[model samples]
Target: MSILIDSAVVLKSYNNNIVSVTINEEERILFAKGIGFGKKFGDKIEKGTEVEKIFILEDEDNLRNFKQVIENVDENFLILCETMISYIENELKEDLDERIHVALVDHLNFAVQRLSNNEEIENPFLMEIKALYEKEYTLAEKVAETLQYEKGVNIPVGEIGFIALHIHSARNCGKLSNTLKSTHLINSIVEYVEKQIEVQIDKTSLDYARFVTHLRFAIKRILSDISIKNDFIKEIKSKYKLSYKIASGVSKILIEQLQKNVTVDEIAYLAMHIERLRIATIDK
Candidate 1:
C-alpha cells in the first residue's frame, strides 16, 4: 500500500497549512501539519515552515517518476541549497526573517524558470545543484542555528531556505550576480580558494581546499570588525601558518590583475593571502 506520486510534481503552498502538488494528470492537496527537521506529517500542515516531505499519489506512473526524479534531483538540489543558505546567512546578518523569506521566493522562481528554458539539465553539474536545492531549508536552519546559537547571531530557517533557493535559481540561470553579496561572497571566496588550491596543489587539492575554506571562515570571524590594515598579512600567517603564504600570494595577484576595480580591502587581502600561500608552498 505504498502511495504513488510524480517526482516532478511541483509543490506549491497556498497560504494556509495547505499545499497543492501537481504532477501529470494527478493533483492533490495536503494539509502541511508541520514541516521542520525531524517532524512527521500527519493530517495537517503548518502555515509556513520548512519540512522534509513526500507526496502521495494514486497513480503508479507518477510514483515511478517520483522515485526516479527524487533519486536524480536530490543530490544536486542539496548542494545548491547549502550554497544558497550559506550565502543568505552571511548577507542578512541582522534581518534574518526578511532575508530568508525573500531568498526562498527568489530561488523557487528561478528554479521554475530554468527548468522551462534549459534543455538536458540531466548533466552531472546540474544534478549536483539540484541535490543542493533539495536540502535548502534544513541546511539553512542548521547554518542559522550554528551562526546564532553558537555565535550569537539570528538567522531563521525560512530566510535560509529562501536564500538557498535564490542561489540555486541564479546558478541555474548562469547568473553569478545574485550571489555577490555577504554570505554569498563568503561562499564565492571559498570557491575561489578551493579552485586555486586544486589547480596548484594537484594530488592534495581537495584536502587543501577544505583547509582553506575553514581558514577563510576563521579569518572572517577574527577580522570581522577592524578596517583592513597591512597587519592583515601578519595576522593570517600567525593564525594559519601553513596555508597563509600561498593563500596570501594568490590573493595579491588576483587583486592586482583581476579584481582591479574591486574596492573591498578585505577581499584584496584575502586574494593576497591565497597568493602567498601558493608561493610559499612552491618554494618549499
Candidate 2:
C-alpha cells in the first residue's frame, strides 16, 4: 500500500522558491525554500508542505495584479519584497491589505532600479510625511534595512518616505493618491497659517503635532462625507476671530482642492486648532 496526500494545484510558478496554488478553492502564493524548483503550472503541492510563508490574497484584483508583478519582476526582487512584507507584518502585528503586496513590490522593484541607475528621488513632502505618518515612517525605515541587505542598495530617505506612503495607504485600505492629497492639503494650510500669523510652525511642538493630526483626520472625514458636530462653532467663530478668518481661508482652499463643500463645523474645528497654534505664541 502507498501513502496518499491531498495537495494544491499549482496555478503559476515563480522560480525555484515560490508558486501560486489553488487549494481548498482559495488562491494562495506559497513560499518555501525551493518550493517551486522544477515546478510548473498544474503541478500538485502537498497541502501540508512546510512553508516559510503563505500569502492568501482574498481580493481578486490583488491576486491578479500580484501574479502579474511576480511574472514580470525578477524572482530575487520579488523575494526581497516578500522579506520586507514579512517584516512589516511582524512589526505591525496585523495582516495588511493584499493590495500592498501588489503596490509595494512593484514600487520597490522600480525604486531599486532607479537607485541603481543613480536617479535622484525627490520628495518635497518628506517632512510632512514624517510628521503625519510617524508610525508608518518608522516601519518604512526598518524596511529600508531589509532592502539594503537583500538588494545591496541603500534606500534613500526620500524613498523611505515613499515606502511610508505605501504602508500608510495600505494599512488604512486607502489609496496612495488620497494620502498624498491630504499631505499636500495639510502643508498648504500650514503654509497659509504661517503667512497669516507671521509665524513659522514649530514642527517639534506637541501642539503642532496635534494640529497636523487633526488636519489628517479632518481631511479623511471630509472625503468620507462624515461631518462632525462642533457645539462651540459659534464661540470659535466669535472668540478666535483671527483664527476663524484664517480657517475660512483654509476652507476655501479645501473647497477648491476637494471640490466638496466644507462645513463650518469643520471650519470651527480647524479654527480651534489654529487658535491653539496662535495662543502658543502669546505672552512670549
Candidate 3:
C-alpha cells in the first residue's frame, strides 16, 4: 500500500535522520528517522521503505523551512503532516507552497495535542476568516471533519479559522499572515463609506471590484514598506473632502492594525477610489 512512485537514489544525508534523494533523476529531500541512519552518499533507497515524509523543495526558501521541520519535529508528526498536505493538494487541485508542510503540520500537531489535553484556544478573527475565505474555510472544515473521523480527535470549531488561515497562506504562496486583518480593514472601510453616503454597495459592481483591488495592493504596499507620493494631495483633499474624511478613518484603522504609517498620498488615492465607488453606487 505504499503510495510513493518512481524509485529514488539517496544523494546525501542531511543528518542521521534525514537524507537527500533523487527520484527519476529529480532531487527531493526525504525525512524518515533511521532511513538515513548508516546510509551513505549515492545509496539507492530501498523500494517500499516507509519514509516518514518527502518534500520537493522547489527553491531555497522551501529547503530552509524543510530543514527546520526536520531538525525540530518528531518523525511521527511529519507523517501526519505529509498525509494532510497530500489530501489537500489532491482535493483542491492546487499546488501549495512547500512552507505549508512546516506551518500547517506544526499547527495541527500542536492543536490536536492541546485539544486532547483539554486545552483550547480561541480564534479572534474567525468571523472575518469565514466571511472572506469561504472556500478555504470550507476546505478547513472538511480537514477537521476528516481528522475527527479518522484520528478520534474533535478539533474545535475555532481551529477552523486558524486552519483556513494556513490554507489561504499556502494557496497564496505564504504571503497572507495578516490576511484576516487586511480583510477586516477593507470591509470596515467599505462599510463606513457606504453608511456615510447612505448607500449599499453592489459587491458585483466593477467599481467595487476596482476598489477592492486598490485596497488589496494598498495593504501589500503598507506591509512591504512601499508608498506612493501624490503631487496633488492637497487638491485631492480639498476636492473630495467627504471621501477624504472617510479615507482618513480607514487610514487610522490601517495604522491601528498594521502599526504602519499611511502617507497622505495613500489616503488621497483611497479617497479618490472611494469617491468613484460612491458615485457608481449612487448611479446604480
Candidate 4:
C-alpha cells in the first residue's frame, strides 16, 4: 500500500541518507538511502516519489529516541523492521498498538548493531515471557526467523524473549508489567475466595465468567496505573458485609502477592461480584 505523504516539506537531512520531514504539519522522520541526498533545507518532498519508508513519531519522547537511533541504523534495517511488523500483524491477525513501530524498531536496530559487534545481551525474563505470552513468544521466534532469512543475521534465542516483551507491551498498551504474574495473582484470589466460602465454583457458569472478566479488568487497571473511585463505598460495606470481607481478603492478596493496591471502588465492585457468586454457589 502506498501511504501518501500530504504536503511534506523536508526539515533537515542527516548523512545524506535520512531526512526529517513535516507531513500535514506533523513532524516525521523518513528513512531511505539517498533520501536526503542533494536536498536542501525547506525542500518540498513529493509524496510517493522520494519517500520509500516513513515512520510517524507519536510523542515527543518517541521522536527524540527515534532521532537518536536512526543516526546509527541502516536504512535496510529500518525497512526490514517495517516488513517484520507487517508480517507479525498479518500472522497474528491483530492490529498492534502504534507504539510497537517505534519500540520494536529501536530494539531491533540496537540488537542488530550489537550482534554485528559480537555483543549479545541476555534476557532474564525469557522463561517468564515464554510461560505468560506463549503466542507472542512464538510470533517473536518467527520474527527471528524472518531476520535470519532477510538480513542474514542469526539473532540469539535470548533476543526472542526481548522481542516477546515488546510484543507483550504493545498488546497491552501502556501496561508493561509481567502478565504471568497477573494471571497467577488472579488465580490465587479466586482460589482464596472459594476456600474461604467453602463452596465449589461452577467454572462453566455465566456467573463465573462474569467474575473472571471483572478480575481481568481489575488486574489490568491496577497494572495500568488507573484507579476506580468508590462513590458507594459506604453503602456496599454496610449492605454486603460478608462479600465486602471477602473482597478485603482479595485486596490483601493483591498487595501481598502482586504488590498492587485495589481502590475502594474496585473493592466495592468485587464485593458485588462476590455476592453474586456466593448466591450462585448456594443455589447450586
Candidate 5:
C-alpha cells in the first residue's frame, strides 16, 4: 500500500534503506528494503517507488525526538533499529506504536555502547518480567540471539527483559510509566516483606522468583479490579500470623496506591505466599 507523495526531497538517509524526506512542508519518512540506496540530500524520490513503509510522525515532540536520535546515533545502528522493528512486527503480526522507534533505538544504542565499556546491567525484575510477559520475552530472546550472532553483542538476560518490556509496550501502546509503576510497586512490596521479616532474601532463589511472580499477578488483579474468593482467609491469617502481619502492611501500600480496599481474600493469598518465602529463608 504505497501512498504517492507529490514531492519528496531526501533530507537524510539512514543505512541506504530509510530516508527522512521532506514531502511538501512536512517531514515524511520513506523506508523500504533499498529505497535510499545511492540517495543523497536534495535527491527527489521517484514516483511509484515500491517503498515498504511511510512513517508520518504527527506529534511534534515525537518527531523532533526521533530526528534528534537519528542525528546523534550511528546511521548503521539506526538502520538496525528499523530492521529490529520490522522483525518485531513480523513476529507479532501487528503494527506497533510509532513511539517505539524513538524509545527502543535510543535504549539499544545506549545499552550496546555501555555494554561495550563493561558497565554492569542489572534487571532485578527479570524473572517477574519473563513470567508476566511470556510471549514478549520469547520475542526478546530471539532479538538478543540475533544481536549476539550478527552484531556480536551478547545482551544479558536483564537487557532482554528490558527489550521484552519495550516490545510489550509498543504492541499494546502501553505507557512505560505504568509498567514501571507496577514493577516499582512489586519491588516495594518485596522489600517491605523482607524488612518485616528481618531477612535478606536471596534474589536468585526459586522462592524469590515465586514471590515476585505472585506479586506481579496480584498487582495486576488489584489494578484490573479482579478478585478471587478466599473462604480460608481467616484460617490462613490465623495460621501464618507473621505473614499475615506483613500482608497487612502490604495491604496498606496497595490501598494507598489504589485508593480502594484490597479484599481480605487477596491479602490472605499474599500472606500464604509470604509465609512460603519466610519458610524458605529460614530453611536456608
Candidate 6:
C-alpha cells in the first residue's frame, strides 16, 4: 500500500532513522524509515507538498494500527478512549458518531504526546511510566479537593473518571514506585475527605495533573516527617475530628515507625500541615 503526505510536515525528531512527521490534519503520524538521501536536508516540504511511500497498510488499517501502537506506547491512550465513551454516553442519539470520535482521539493524542514527550516511550521500559501516571492520578484527586475547599467549586465527575482511568491503567501495569503506592494510600484518604466535604472538585484546568503531582510529592514529605517524628498522628486526628478514622488509617501506616503511641492529635496535624504546604506550593 502507498501513503501520501498531504502537506508540508516538520520532522519533529528521528529515532534509528524513523522520522516522526507532523502535519495539521490527520494525527496519524508518518513513520517513513530509510527513505534515503536529500530528504535529510530538511527541505521545505511546504504546506502543500505531497510525497508517496509504500507501506503494508491501507487507510483505515493504518489508523487502527497507529492507535494500537499509541496505546501500547502511552498508557494515557485509555484516557482518550474513555473521553470518547463519555461523549457517546452524553449524546442523545442511539448511534454514536464514530468518525468524529476517531478524529478527536487521534488529534488529542498527537497534541498531548508532543507536549508530554509521550512518543518517546520505550516498549519494555514502561515501569517508570506506569508509576508516573499513577502518581499523577492520585495527586489530581487531592488538588481537586483543595480547589473545592478554597474556591467553593466542585470538580466534575468526568475528570475524576478520567483520573480513575489512569489509576486503573497504572495499577494494571503493575510497575508503580514506592512513592506512587504511598500516594495511592493518601488518595484513598483524600477521597474520603471529598465525601465528607460533600463537594466535587473539578480538574479540567490546564496543568491540573501537574498541580496534583506537586501536592503528592509535598504530602510525601509530610509522611516522611511523621515517620521521623512520632507526634504527627495525634495532631491530625484532633484537627479533622470528623475525619479521624480516615486520618488515623493514614497515620497508622505512615508512622508505623512511631509505634504504640500514635494519637489522633498527631494525625490531624499531619493532614493540616500537608494541606497548608500544598496550598503554598501548587498553582491555582
What lDDT tens digits, residue by residue, belong to model 4 across residues 210-229? 57656765675576556555
Candidates sorted on TM-score, descending: 2, 5, 4, 3, 1, 6
Whose lDDT is higher: candidate 5's or candidate 6's? Answer: 5
For model 4, the superposed segments whose C-alpha errors exceed 4 Å read 3-5, 15-17, 31-34, 47-51, 116-120, 174-284
> What TM-score should be assigned to candidate 4?
0.55
For all predicted structures, in order, the TM-scores are: 0.26, 0.60, 0.52, 0.55, 0.57, 0.26
Error of 5 at 154 (Å): 1.4
Clashing pairs in 3: none
Backbone clash total for model 4 is: 0
Q: What lDDT would each prediction earn against the true structure?
A: 0.41, 0.79, 0.75, 0.75, 0.78, 0.40
Q: Pick the candidate with the highest TM-score.
A: 2
Per-prediction tally of clashes:
64, 0, 0, 0, 0, 24
Candidate 2 per-residue C-alpha lDDT over 61-130 given as tens digits, one digit per residue, 9 for 90 to 100: 5576677777878987787788788788888888776767877787788898999899956764578778
Per-residue CA lDDT of model 5 for 58-177, tens digit only, reads 766567667777777887677777788888999888888776787778778878887778895677567777887899999889878877776687789999987887787677544567
The global Cα lDDT (0 to 1) of model 4 is 0.75
Q: 2 or 3: which has the higher lDDT? A: 2
Rate residue 96 of model 5 by lDDT.
Answer: 83
Off by over 4 Å in 3: 1-18, 22-27, 31-38, 46-54, 174-284
Per-residue CA lDDT of model 6 for 182-284, tens digit only, reads 5576566446545644444333322223333333433433533322233445555556455555446555655553234444445554456444434433433
Better of 2 and 6 by TM-score: 2
RMSD of each: 16.7, 15.7, 15.7, 16.7, 13.3, 18.3
Determine which window of 10 residues in candidate 2 has minimal summed lDDT: 1-10
lDDT, candidate 1, 1-284, per-residue tens: 12333332335543333344554545653333432223232323333333333345443433333333333333334334434444554654422322222234333334444534542122212233234466544444555454444334344334454434444333332323422433354445556655756644422232333334333333432333323334355555576554554455444544443433322445445545465556555665
**Model 6: CA > 4 A from native:** 1-174, 177-186, 204-246, 249-269, 273-284
User: Higher-lDDT candidate among 4 and 6?
Assistant: 4
